[model samples]
Target: MVDLQVQYQQLKGEIDRALAAVLDTSHYILGPQGQAFEAEAAAYLGVKHAVAVASGTDALHLALRAAGLGPGDEVITSPFTFIATAEAIAYVGATPVFVDIDPQTFNIDPELARKAITARTRAILPVHLFGQPADLAPLQAMCDEHGLLLIEDCAQSFGATYAGRQTGSWGALGCFSFFPSKNLGCYGDGGMVVTGDDRLAEQLRMLRNHGSKVRYHHDIIGYNSRLDEMQAAILNVKLRHIDRFNQLRRQNAHYYSERLADAGVVPPREDGKGVHVYHQYTLLTDRREAVQQALTTAGCASAIYYPIPLHRQNVFAAAFGGVSLPVSESVAARCLSLPIFPELNQEQMDRVVAAVRGA
Candidate 1:
């Protein structure tokens, strides 16, 4: 789905130098690189603080903990997202209230989410699926009216913006991932949580480091979730070129949309409320299996972001088996993501378009 090898070659010198510096210093944990990356990321996202974590899942898990969500609390989120979105709530002994997604944008429906809110609902966690920012205005207003926390799962969106503000800066706490395939990813597993609240930032910092502010003294139970120095160093180098990377993705996506306009598929729609970084150039087609087969025959790649909604998954089936979310189910059955990256050339895009049209 991506060409990491080519990207690495493009930044070989800088990445190698960053790695060498980290190795020479021998400060793998809580090192200068990680600290610097956190500050740089915070500045880029226009947030007050950013805490690096081991993985994107850890970022979400720790954010829920820092927000004081527990047993009886419920977090409203979309069922169309990756499993980790709901898993984080479950990790903190909180309930995940699954809701349907908007048909066009494929993000959590704000009206559905508001309807799902109950007395037990303590937070609304919105996922920016496929680097498209969710409609946060209504969701934020609903949260404010109910005095609920607003957390964002920005795992797929690194530099995406909504209403002229960055996605990670919209909510109380925003979580990001560096899973190598993301718009702004590192060499390996890395994640961050950005927030404007000072109290949440301190809690996240302590929670990531064994709940100790004074090194030895422990304040509460915490997990080992710090982002390693090597990964952080790699991220620092990549972060410098994130804007150009996103621009390329947007350009490539627009080209694909134009080519596929009459190719018997529904191109992704941008709501105009935000910038979509095109983490994946996904489209909806009734003939998904045939298109996938054609791409495979043409030596091109295509994937399904999610084949099953969260509420329908076996893990949550017992509790939510009877729940029905028609939109999520319908979209999951038809969505197919084509290969999209900053390095994608015209020849590659033409080949992909031809395969889809031929199918």
Candidate 2:
């Protein structure tokens, strides 16, 4: 949907220079560029430490492993998310307990999360779906009451904020993706884990690199997951303009909201304290399939953030045991994402609105 051609054209020179520098150094993995990017990312997110990894899935996996979560441990998370959120839990041999989402924000319903917690509940992994921040106050309160860690699946939210703070900093650990489709994406797979606690950050670092604080001396069983120097270099270049790009996305979202406000579609609702980046401008309507197809036929790209809820997914259903959540199922069927990016203009937005309403 996004014209990445335009994006690269604008930032081509800087990006090429960054890549050339990394290649000339002959250091491709976990080199100077990765370290510099990590520092900048941590500072931007206002967190103490940031660990770069291979992908958001690895970020979630390591975040959970670093916290000492393993088999038999139950993690409370919303079922209305991409499979990766629950898949990470399953990868760590942890139980993926399903929770419903708030009808408005489509984030984990804290009440449902609290209800899902038990002696086995080790963490609450809330996915910030479609770039909206989850309600943190209630989630934090529940986690505190139950002594559970909070890991935010921030794959969709990079610039989004909750209560004036970034989305990734609210929980114990925030896992972010740098997939090409994301707000601050790299050329290929990249991810980072941000944490306020120094000890936890240390654990995460060790986990990402063969569980060794010192080279070649293993402290615990870990995996091989590192942010390649090339991807890190590219991300650093993109980081400079991320704020402006997100602002443009916000303006485009406003245009769509104004035009489609009365198109029998429910637009996203932002929290008073949350600065939504509009990574994906999604809407709810009974005619989601028709609307999406109509937009595509009309030359406006459209997609569904997730067509299947996690609870119903065969993998999660087999691993997490049984659960019945109505809200999540409904959202999976109705929510649709339109072409939303920093480069999209008012004219394109008007056409998308027209297609949807016309459908």
Candidate 3:
């Protein structure tokens, strides 16, 4: 759904120079480029530390491990999200408790998350789905009252804000993905873990490496999940333009919302508590298949973010089978993501709107 070639061409000079510098240095792993990118990302997010990793999934796994979560621990999260949200918790040997989402915002419902808590509930992992931040004030208050950790899955919310503060600055740990399609994407796979705590930051850095603070002196078991220097360099160039890109995305989303006001489709909601970056301008329609087919026939691309909720996945069905989550299930079956990228123009957007109206 993204035109990476066009984006690259727009930032050609800076990206080419950055890659050339990395090549000249020949330092591929956790080198100066990665370190500089981490500092820039930390400053942008207003967090004390940002630990770069190989993938977003790795970032979530290391964050959970640093928080001392393991077997017997439970993490409450929404079912209407990318599988990696739950996979990270499962990777850390923690049980993922599925909660329903708010139908309007399509985010984890705070009340449902609170009700799902138990003695074993150690953390509340919330995803900022489709670039809209979850209602974090209540979730943060609940975490404080229960002595639970709060983790934000910010894979699609790179430039979003809530309550006048950046999204990744909330919670104990905020995980981000730099997949090429994200708002602040790099050339390839990359991710980061942001935190305000120094101790947790240290643990995350060591864990991303082979648990060796000092060379060859392993302190604990860890994983090899370091961000590549080249990708970091590319991200550094892209980061400089992320705000402008997100603003364009917001404009495209507004056009879509205005056009589809009474077209029997539900556009994404902006709750006034946060600014949406429009990672995906998703629409909800009962006739999802027909709408998508129309878009395809009209040369417009569309996709479903998640057709199956986490609770119904075959891998987790044995444990969460027969669970009834009306909102998440219904939303998953009807949600359709439209072509939303900074490169899209008015002509493209009009075509998509006309196709939807025709459908």
lDDT of 3: 0.94
Highest-scoring model, lDDT? 1
Q: Write the per-residue lDDT of candidate 1 for residues 2-75, one digit (tens) a residue.
A: 99999999999999999999999999999899999999999999999999999999999999999999999999
Error of 2 at 248 (Å): 1.0
Backbone clashes under 3 angstroms, per model? 0, 0, 0
In candidate 2, stretches whose alpha carbon ends up further than 4 angstroms from where it belongs are 319-322
lDDT per residue for candidate 2 within 1-359, as digits (tens), equals 67888899999999999999998999998899999999999999999899999998899989988888899898888888778888888888988888888888888888888877788889998888888888888898888888889899999899889888998998999999999889999988999999989899989888889888899999988888999999999999999999998899888888888888898999877767588888898889999878988898889998887788877877655654466678878888899989989987778878888898899
- Model 1 alpha-carbon miss at residue 94, Å: 0.7
For residues 171-246, could you state the per-residue lDDT of candidate 3 as single tens digits? 9999999999999988789999999999999999999999989989999899999999999999999999999999
Worst 10 residues of 1 by lDDT: 181-190
Residue 300 of model 3 has an lDDT of: 94
Which portions of model 1 miss their true places by more than 4 Å? none
Ordered by lDDT, highest first, the candidates read: 1, 3, 2
In model 3, the Cα lDDT at residue 177 comes to 97
The true-structure Cα RMSD of candidate 1 reads: 0.6
TM-score of each model, paired residue for residue: 0.99, 0.96, 0.99
